[model samples]
Target chain A: MVFSKEVKSVRTQTWIGIMSVASLVAIAGIFLKVAMSTQPREENYENITKPGYAIRRKYFWALLIVSVVCLVISVISFPYPAIMEAKITGEPVVVKATGFQFGWELDKDVLPVGKPVRFDVTAKDVNHGFGIYYHGKDGSLKKGIFVAQTQAMPDYINKLYVTFKDPGVYRIWCLEYCGAAHHIMTYEFRVE
Target chain B: MDVADRSMYERRVSGIALGYGAITLVLFGVTVFFGVIMRTSQGEFISVRPDVLYEFMTLHSIGAGGSLMAGVMAVMWYTLRKHLDMSMNIMQVVFGIIGAAVVTIVAVTLLGYYGTGWTFLYPLPFKSAGAWYDFAPGMWLLALMCVIFAFAMSWIDVIRAASKKYGFSNAMGWTLISGTAKPENVPPPVVLISTVTAACGLLSLVAGFIVVSLMLIHWANPSYYLDYLFIKNLIYYFGHIVMNMIMYMCAAIVYELMPIYANRPWKSNKIVAISWNSAFVAVTLAYWHHLLQDFPQPLIFQFLGVFGSYMAAFPATVVTITGTLILIYKSGMKWKVAPLYMYLGLMGWAIGGFWAVMDAGFNQAVHNTMYVPSHFHTYLLVGAAFIFVGGLYHITEELGGCRDTFEDKLGLWTWFVGGYGFVLWFMISGVLGTPRRYAVQMPGTEIYSTAAVYFAWTVVFGLLIAIARYLTRLQSVKPLRG
Candidate 1:
């Protein structure tokens, strides 16, 4: 409910931005104060005031309450991760994708569009990141944009949730570093 | 022990601290050089073989993280031992294990060609697919296990020594929180180090045990299975905790030492104690934040991660930064080279913590592609590294009975300017959304990456200056006798 503003999603960036500004301000203030403060040969500020125990106690409680509030707000509105939240309603086309150190092997090279394709990603030789990307006009992985992906670890199957709505060629590139050829680990599949 | 014997023993330990800290500094230098090489390669300013780049990648990652750990531990232990009695035998054991671990790790990466990257991620280590030798992964894992065990042992010793001095309850500053004892009764160093040692010890056990056990099983049977998500959490947490602990450990040094320069007593107060206690929880739960983008991670944990990540920032200011600020407030600060680093180190910690909190969000995870590495580098390089280097400057100056020299200023400014410049480029690239860990980057990323390389050279110059100063200072000390 707290993130129920115009964006519909929690604007975490705004909060971070505010915090960043505050941080810069605090740092600058401290640095200036330190730079400007009188430098003496010996310590001179005798019997600097210390707060009463009561004020300290109040601060302790205030911090505790603030922490509790933050925790509560986050807890109450916590949504399932994206994949979990948008579980496919109908049966999906199953695809078995195997990741090797340098390449990928899918059940089929071309995937049929319109049906949700559920990829059971597994690594044959080593762990590789199975990031599905679509290349831009430059035709370089450098220009490749991410679509959907999951880590392909050996001896483990990661069921990646995806449903391609449009016809296009996509590439499965290893995201996690496996070895020398990790960057070269890629497989292209056509969605028609 | 007689005063003469005690002083001799203290001198011996001081020599060991200087020796170990120097080794770590060397290791840091090597890794930073390789890091520049990789950045330049990725930026396409120069061309290198793919395998070679990756080999350097793997080495640089682990080398930086691991060496920093060993380096800071020695600095902290040296300071700690001066205050209370510690087992010299235990120190020797730690030194031996670290020596063995670093040798094995460097050998496997450079000589044996283990290039799976430091996370070793999981299944990747088991299935190198002929890129690396079969046994190399196992050896790397064993090396990591050795380092983990050694560090854990060191922490255990610190905890035991501290608890004994303060009675275990007061050691953690819990009595301050409970209001059973006055805050002044317990030293702030004990509270900070005790909390970090205990938390890191327990969490490291969880991570180390799970990972090494799973890894051993794979080595033994090759048919045995482990869950992907489980292994991911374990390895990530292990790495995260270690990185997080570096901040805590070095901050411990700052809290204890900085006030000495500023002429203020950093007493363990309600806010300070509470902030740190909160940090203990925050650092642990913050691990889940790293896994937020993973589809399989639980929803509540993701929320907890958000909360935890934010919680960590509290101590950064309320305890460490503000505490320093208040300590230095209008008090005549000496502004020595060592204390200057400490002050900047606090600035680094605050700035880096802010960047980290920004990147921790699930929505912002996309933006974190490059920002993650930048945030961490900012914290580690400028933040924790500064505090620690400052501490070293303090220790060397104090023990060597030397005065601050013009040479010290040269070392100080160069390191500061060059280090900050390099990190600035990284953050700039992050803001521009240049993805990290990519062997190669897009055209748009080249400028920032190229700039980083130039600044890196500046850092090297600074390091050379620092090394020269330290060497001159250390030259006065007599060699330790057997």
Candidate 2:
């Protein structure tokens, strides 16, 4: 047998190799152009005004260099995209006071009328629309954050600005729809 | 008709249809079970929680989407080969199945990334780790290749077959050209709709390939997200149009196939065809409506999209109302479960089509939240599901099988009632403001809890009915073969 096992047809092989190389080069050029075009401005998460808008660090050029280097090193080598997370803070929180069949429960179970403390409210199961029902305090109802669902991530944490005006027991319940015991999934918290 | 020739062709087509239907049945079962898990696990976490959630979601989407797609293909092929006298290459048909299978696998893999349903948004593909779940871009590309190849081959065969029988200017062409018209006066509306839908599928393949390729590029280089929402734009058009194509394909099956049972051939061919083609072209521009729901796409495109959205329903309504009324009123007919199922399917399609069209109203967009999908799912699941069932029923004899027993009838009815009840309950919950895919809803803020009780009971009853019917059918398979 020939040392090269009858080397493949030169013209056909050369054409395919050239074509592939040209295609790859074209693709690389386009990629580099995109990567070098403009570094993505770091999303300014500290801009408390916009809750979910994240400004990530400009790493597009770095990523581009790595991708190009990989392509040159091994065309068959798969490229794993980098994970970019924008930390969101100062998001609004909503605490539901009522609409629960049985009513709302506090972690401490009760609070004095004048007590000042911060409470983070979350749905035990399913999403419950909750927020203090008051006039002009921007009585916006907070929808539960569906963890893992990107759509619900923003709505997950809502900040509540409220002060108990009177002494009473407030009730909260799961609002959206959990299951068979959903109606019974309620609790009461008292302020005095 | 030559008995051998008819039997040979019939047997082959039926064989393929049966195989497709059987696989579809299994997929449906998988989807329902996984759907229960996905639904039940909301707000609650089990060990392997995210992974399980991912698994359930992946299988659920693929099972629902892929099974329906296969059902559409099987029925469309059966209708064309038998009713329309359109002969396709056997190899091409097999290739189409292979493509679907490959796509199913790719779809499942993508689900691991839990890409958040079929319209996997671009930037997210690399943003989240749970989303990737060890899935590579190669799988997606391979699957894409399979589907494109399959559709390309099928497209070739359809052109060859239809062209051989009728020229480019044939009535079939008129349906695509002018929209829906009278059969006697124009071309067969069903054929026209099917052809146009297939054409859309071809176009979608192009877009899908481009989008998938872009996704691969993004995977290779994270910086590609800065590339100006290029992939995002392609996906909206590709995903929406492909979905419409699937729906149109199911509609095509019923429009053509239901007539045989009713003893009425399709009429108003040119009008119907023209309506579908118009719908097809209009929908190509309409996908931007989804964009208006979120993200930054041009407002003008959204305006055009809203208008285009309505165009799809015009054909849907014209075909459904006119066809069903003719079948029921003009033609004196006895009520059988199969034909009843077809009518029910028509109702579902019409209702869903109406809701989808209605939801496009600018003011009405807010209320579309969960209800829109509920309304649309009625068409996707019940409408399309019933047609698939009807096709299966029709092909029973040809599949070397038949559902002759009273139990089988009961089982078929069970499928009908169960499917309808499930979808109706699901849709009603949406209307009541129960968000879709919530692991759990809070106790009292919404009425969905009450609806959930009803929904759960309905599902249980429906599941029992389905199991009984499936068992009965399994037992009777032997007798039907003889």
Candidate 3:
């Protein structure tokens, strides 16, 4: 299946970049403004004698609140795990995954497209990351990053809920460096 | 003889601080080689196994972070001691503990192949999936526990000293909270370090508990388990605090040294006091932002974490930055490398900090992306690293009677250029969706590593010149006893 790769929000990214660059330019501008300034040094501007500090303090606090509010809003909008709040319209394909020394084992392989899949992951021997990757339009076998993941604990199961709208060959890789052949830890699946 | 009235306590503390700084510098030098090697391997210029690369990752992160903290802490202990009566006994003991911890850390990474990254999150340390000896994680945990104990002890000493001079509330800049005392009376550094000490002290205790808990589980019931979320939070809380404290304490160095370099007094004011106090309040919840991707962690925490982080982080950087810019505005001080590094450090801190805030902000979804490693590396290397180095150089030149001249401007420029270049690699790579801590590199990822490898070598060369100068000059001169 072909789709534009991970329609990463250009607007969001651009906004973040603008904020980052704007802050830099502002700080740098102020730094340059101050560093290059040949203004005569004022005397007795130590704490009590400093003027406009009240105004500075007021502005500082106001900016602090504004930035924090902005940050919280950004966090809310950013992509978060829909697992907890997800209302399943239909039953999610439940795949039981067990991880061990060198590999991953899944109970089933085929997953339907436009469906939610719940990966119930656990470890038989140790800790592992149940990281699932989708086949990009470029069709690369994902080794490093993954689409959805959760901890595969030895005694407890970690449930990860993910919905794939596009059908593609996907792979699961252990993200946590487990052992010597950890690089070889991979499992492939299908979305039909 | 020096004209200053010398106290034995002062001399002893200074000696230990120098000792710590020396060890830190040496550790950083070794770790940089590992970093360079890892980058080269990632660039596909060399062939190495995934395990080896992972091992180096663990070694390099802990080694460099530990080294920088030690260097800056030495400066903190040295400078703070002069102003406030810090504990000599605590300093001495920690100095010894740090030595032991360093040896053990090196052994665990080199000899035992403890490849669980510095975070050592959850059960990864307990169960290495057949890569390392069972003892490797145990040894690493114990060493880390020891390091935590030493750090906690030192922090306790700071708390005690601050509390002794100023009451706990005032030491924490409670006047800012209550609007009782004037900001000028609340000394910024004391308030700053005390706040940091409290946060780190709590984190260390939590770390100690988890380490001991994990050890007990290891020995008694090998099959025993933990709430992965709980352990993950604890470990990151410890790691985050450790990383930030390296900056917080180093900021003390900047707070003390920057003024001296500029020949001005950076007095405590309403802004400084309020900012530092706010940090004390907000820092407690900030580490949770690190776990926004962990799914199992609640959304409420993610929100709280992001808010707490920005609140804690923004104020101090803003106040210090504005303060520094204003200090240098009209002060006609010569821009020596020491002071230049200070300016550069502050600039890096501000820029890097912006990246960090963005990474924390959920709207970006940059956490766990390439953005994480790049932003952190920016802060750690360009921001915290420069602050600690500049502060150390300042302390040494003034008090330790060391003069460094005819140094490699070539090396310095190369370092600055390469450092920024390497930082850009991380930022760009992160933006382009290159994952961090990947043992084996994907094809496109090699491009970032290739650029980083060349840039890293320049950084190493610059450091080599700087370190050579420091060691030669410092070796002949004992901190203050001479």
Name the top TM-score candidate. Answer: 3
Per-residue error for B206 in candidate 2, Å, reads: 1.6
lDDT for position B416 in model 3: 74
- The DockQ leader among the candidates is 3
Please give me the DockQ of candidate 2 compared with the native complex: 0.01
lDDT for each residue of candidate 2 in B1-482, tens digit (9 for 90 to 100): 59767666655554566656665555665576666555545423322255445545555765577666766776777676643555546544654656566455646564544333454555444444333543544465456556556655665555555555554345346633554433343445565666667777778778887887777776677666434245556876877777677677777777776666555556544446556667777788777655443222354565566667655555565445444443443243444555555666666676666555444433111222355555666677667666676666656633435445565556555555555555555454443333443334443224443443344344444544544454344433332342
The 10-residue segment of model 2 chain A with minimum total lDDT is A77-86
Q: Worst 10-residue stretch by lDDT in candidate 2 chain B? A: B360-369
Q: lDDT (0-100) at residue B360 of candidate 3? A: 76
Residue B286, candidate 3: Cα error in Å is 1.4
Measured on C-alpha atoms, candidate 3 has an lDDT of: 0.69
TM-score of model number 1: 0.85
Per-residue C-alpha lDDT of model 3 across residues B363-441, encoded as one tens digit per residue: 2334454567767777777777777667667666766666656673444566677787787777766654454566666
Every candidate's lDDT: 0.70, 0.49, 0.69
lDDT per residue as tens, model 2, A77-185 = 1111111111212322233332222234454655555433234443322233332211111212233211101110112332222334445544443432222233344
Chain A TM-score for each of the predictions = 0.58, 0.31, 0.67
The DockQ for candidate 3, computed on C-alphas, is 0.37
Better of 1 and 2 by DockQ: 1
Clash count for each candidate, listed in order shown = 2, 50, 3
Inter-residue clash pairs, candidate 3:
A74-B363, A75-B362, B370-B430
